[model samples]
Target: MAILPEPVTLSLICILVMMCVKILMDQTKKNKYHFPPGPRPLPLIGNMHILDIKRQDYTFMELAKTYGTFFTFHFGRAKAVVLIGYEANQEALVKANYDFGDRAPMPIADDFQKNHGVIFSNGETWKITRRFTLSILRDLGMGKRPIEERIINELQYLNALIGSHNGKPFNEKVFYNATPNITFSILFGRRFDYDNPNYKKMIGIIDDVVKLTGQPEAKYYNVFPIIKYFFKTPGLVVKRVNELNEVLHEMFKEAQEAKTEDSFRTYSEAFLQKQEREKATETTEKIFTEKNLLASTFDLMVGGTETTSSTLKWAILLMMKYPDVQKKVHDEIENVIGLERPPKWEDHKVLPYCLAVMHEVQRFGNILQYLPHSTPTDVSFRGYTIPKGTIVVPLFSSVLYDETKWEDPRGFNPNHFLDANGKFLKRDEFFAFSKGRRVCAGETLARMELFMFFTGMLQKFSFTPPPGVKKEDLDLTADPFFIMRPKRYYVIATPTI
Candidate 1:
């Protein structure tokens, strides 16, 4: 009977051998990978339990204090190495530049077929997109007359919107929509009319999506990838992103029809021409298509809109909290360029306090709190070995609020950017736009937008808290997002005129 069953016995023995091999492989993997020290983790769940979840700020800062500048944390199956403090950030971003240049592959990125736009793409694709984006921006008259002209147009529209209130207490959010829309126009070569219903609805969707992004619920989705199917929040993000894509696609379709092959005029027009030329090449695989053009355009629209607008929103909130500083800034702007005209990008040279105030807003508000980077290969920095594909976050909060870097790290002080004579002075550590190869491509445009739009608003109106409100009582606290935006609060825009 045993001799007759030899084949079945052999099969059973092979199954046991395979199970043993898998166990040995798993154990070897655990032993071979030496991760950086981190807080105690639960089996399978890892350190997610220890994480503050909602407060990435508090969690990261506290982890740095306990585990040193560089520590590791597990996001489900994936491991993330956090780099805290200025020096750690420098090591990852500068010293190990190329090594820590890759972005972690996520489900969203994968769903996009890993064909992420310039901001998230790695290696050659990223290089090509970034280089071309810079060149195109310059060609489209970034840092030139076109930029100033567009800004002035937008400002005139914004001023009209604000002035419609007849010096009454109207919330600035409606008018503030112009700031982002202007940048969107420059990037996509299309502008939204003031009070456009579709535009307002799009903004509302984006607001909700952005709110859900930095929340615990979003973080929960990130941790448990399998559970994403059951979640509504992540689905909402995807839906909003798709809606944004549809909007951009329609804009692109319009640009394509309006495109004259003889004239490569706007960003979209030039990009479409380039796409056509490259598609004619035998190696069509490498050519960036109209899709890439639209995606890149979308990147600029989202990045520029969210960041620049949020910073300015926070600026008004800060001014409300410190009315004395606000008055000084108002007085300085008035003294330099009177209320007859709104502030222009050119007026930045004379408006020292206004310039300083903008810088202070960027520093103090610190939107885009920490710019996350990732290691592409093994790198040794100051004797510590950084393994391949480790997340290298530049603690932007640390750089923005460095105690050694700033005299008043906690305060909203425009003097932070001023000297004894009150001239605007730039700081090397002010990495608001970040630094090196991966620094923000749209920084020049964003800077111009912020200065022009902010000064434009302040020149026309002195923003004050509502009646019976104390400056101290003004809630300057942020709405707690991936971008630090002030909580919704109405202010009286007393006309400076």
Candidate 2:
């Protein structure tokens, strides 16, 4: 046998020693704590070989059959405890929220946000930012009549845009342009015209960032960040993120210049006023910085836009597929609110069938399958000890589709939310906005947007699959993105009014 060079032999010896040390450390950890049982991980890749990166939630559900609700899964060398089903998710997210409230350290988010925003931030930053955000949103009329009027006003623009389609087959992404303006109305104290160039550019950038972040390659980058050195998509995402930041910074500057004393017109203005107060105080810590402002604004904009628009897309798509159900919703709207007057938030209480259909759309859409959380400290959960800082994935999809919770979990049945007498039934298992400390911040706004846009659209238009396309042929397969959205599909919105 040929003798290896001295340097090569030394490098091999070092690598072997490192691997041995890792094995011994893992063995020691296994012996020390009763970790959740899962498939044994191989070196390097861990459970990734068994996981479908694009649909890890589905893979985790399958794994739950063997490992039960909480199980250990590895992403490369990183350890994670996957929480499956409603019980497990509730236990971690609701009952023991404090223990599992920290946002997991996602490499991509860290690279982009650096723990500055509400979504990916933790500890005091999260607390302060979230508190201020909720207050400002409420002050600006989230979940109230002031915001409802804004949504109602925005609906006119949306209706006009959709009506301009003239019942021709048009891609449902047109909703994307209108939905963010609702968010913008609160954030910047204004809404953009649908045809505005800057508005279109901002939406396009957000669209690209969300889609890129959801791609399987993005998941791979999170697991093995070294891949970013070889891959271009991650770099592209950062570039787009920077472009978005530029837009936000410009808006921030505008808000600062346009500020008036003791008066707040928008969320941005509120945050700036708060920042000035923080500056004037004698405290050493600065909680409300420009970085935080930019990040929080980005979080609200993206959060407010993608999920609502995606849910609306699903609502329209599902209605087209199930015209019978759509007709019932239409008849309910006609009987209760009628076409002459647009649907209001108050109408939801009277329009049980319409409300049921809306709930069913959210349940069936399952736009956000999971958002990863982390244990703030070593957590004793469901008889398993998950180490501190371990990533925990509370699979929301599993909760939404839990077999024991719904009568027909797989089918698109609005009856799931309806009683025998057709009254709307509220199920706790509908974990659409999530739960606990990290529940979606814009839940109220999203709820208002969904009710108004959905009912309003149904009031004016009758949606159907494109000409010659059968309802049965309409595909509901979700496009893989950070937000699970219906694949690009066309619809004919015949004006019913």
TM-score of each: 0.90, 0.94
Off by over 4 Å in 1: 1-34, 108-113, 284-287
Q: What C-alpha lDDT values do all the predictions have?
A: 0.75, 0.89
Error of 2 at 189 (Å): 0.7
Off-target runs (Cα >4 Å) in candidate 2 are: 1-30
lDDT of 2 by residue, 225-318 (tens): 8998988888898889889888888888889998888999999999999999999999886889988988898899899998899899999999
Clash number by candidate, in order: 0, 0
lDDT of 1 by residue, 11-102 (tens): 99999999999999999765656667888777778778777666566677778878887888776666788777667777667776687778
**For model 2, what is the error of residue 283's alpha carbon versus the real structure, in angstroms, after optimal superposition?**
3.2
Candidate 2 contains a number of clashing pairs equal to 0
- Where does candidate 1 have its weakest 10-residue lDDT segment? 107-116
Q: After superposition, how far is residue 78 of candidate 1 from its true place, in Å?
A: 2.2
